[model samples]
Target: MAVITTKGVEKVYNPDKIPVKALKGVDLEIEAGEFTAIVGPSGSGKTTLLNIIGGLDRPTAGYVEVGGEDISQMSDNALIDFRKEHIGFVFQAYNLIPVLTARENVEFVMLLQNRSKAERHARADELLKAVGLEDKVHKRPAELSGGQQQRVAVARALAPKPTFILADEPTANLDSESTANLLDIMARLNQEEGVTFVFSTHDQRVIDRARRVVTLVDGKVDEDLRR
Candidate 1:
């Protein structure tokens, strides 16, 4: 099943002023459980496309369907709620709360959903273990290594049981070993738990691990190769 679908997607910034066309007519589909990488040069609109698909930003024109819902047509508040329920985001910056422990950070999203305290704690523990951070559960972001912090970020993203994960340069800050470990964890999750992942990355390490590579150039899909 196609978990994510984009048709004729376009993004234009400052349309009334100096317009910057970030994306132009992008058509793509990502099936469930696929490990896909959206790769391109700096100006290739990879981030723009990811943002649109993830509902973080709306497109100038196009249709975006995530988990079969037309997110492009949703209101800002609606989009926000939709994202919380369906999309998981992992940024390059390991955006964890500096004050919260790994377990607390993982429970944050479920808290937003008004989940029971017991449910929240249980899920957090389960995810922290899944990411190999069971021992670091009580540690704060500042107390963990860069790799461990990213692992916590992953666990947090997965806390909501999102339909798919959208990661933007998730390995940009990690060392080689950290990147490898993170990738191994993600690949295992995809295979073992049937998680779906879509990444916008420039790292060759990430590209090498992706089962499908979609290349974009000058705001359009230049090549799409599936391994």
Candidate 2:
């Protein structure tokens, strides 16, 4: 079964006014354990697609199914719960809580899920170690470099062991070396842990690492290439 599936997805903004269509009948299916990238020039609706798949936005038409469940019809609260349990997100900005330490940041989601303190601690430690942030577990976001913070974000995103990860322009703020390091860690996780990752990125570095590339143009799919 596909980890994520979209059929005839469409989105429109300001329907009462300008009605700018963001997605025009998009259809896609992402299998489990696939490392895929969605690429397009500006205003091509890549982010819109990712947001719909991530459950942050609802499509105006069609459906989105994650792990065989149709999410387009879910209530807002249901979607929130569904996202918490199934989808991991890494944004261009680190989005770490400034006051929380790296370990705390990683544990926050588990805490929300009402996991026991011991379980949260153990999982946070393991994920931090997995992301190569073992030594900086106690550092706050302000104390870490941009790359370090992004690494912590990755660790936090993985803490829940979500079915798949959604990353949006994740390498945009990093230097070459940091981007390489982050990509290496993600690749390792994808290979060794069989984690599925879908990214919307413009960076060539990220595009180079993707095993499959889906290109969008003028709110529609233009190309889907598997390498």
Candidate 3:
């Protein structure tokens, strides 16, 4: 099943004045249970496409559909609610709340969804343990190592049981060991639980781990390779 679809997607900045075309009529289909990486040099529209697919930004033209719903036409408020329910985001920066412990940070989104406190606690503990942060569940972001913090971010992303995980430069800040460990956890999840993941990354470590690589250049998909 195709989890995400983009047809003739285009994104332009300052279209009336000095125009910057970030994406030029790009089309893509990302299937369920795939570990895919969108990779390219700087200014290749990788992040732009990611933002569009994740519903963080709207396209200037064309349409985007996720989980069979056309999100391109959704109002800003609707997009926010749609994203909250369907998309899980991980960025290069660990975006965990510094004031919250790992478990609380993981539970934060479920709290927004008005999940019961017991349900939130149970899910947070399960996710933190899944990401190998069981022992650090009570530690705040500031008290954890960089890798541990990223683990918490992953746990938080999974807390919502999103249709797919969208990650941008997720391993950029991690050391070799941490990156490897994080990749291992994600890969295991993808394999065992059939969780889908889509990432935009410049890291070779990340690219090597991806089962599919889609290369973007000059705002278009230059290559799509599956291993």
Query: On lDDT, who's better, 2 or 3?
Result: 2
Give the per-residue lDDT of model 3 (tens digit) for 134-153.
99889999999999998889
Backbone clash count for every predicted candidate, in the order shown: 0, 0, 0
Q: Rate the local accuracy (lDDT) of all candidates.
A: 0.94, 0.94, 0.93
lDDT digits (tens) for residues 95-212 of candidate 2: 9999999999999988889999999999999988998889998899999998999999988888888999999999999999999999999999999888899999999999999999
Candidate 2 achieves a global lDDT of: 0.94
lDDT value, residue 170 of candidate 1? 95
RMSD of 2: 0.7
Q: How many clashing residue pairs are found in candidate 3?
A: 0
- In model 1, how large is the Cα lDDT of residue 70? 96
Per-candidate TM-score against the hidden true structure: 0.98, 0.98, 0.98
Would you list the clashing residue pairs of candidate 3? none
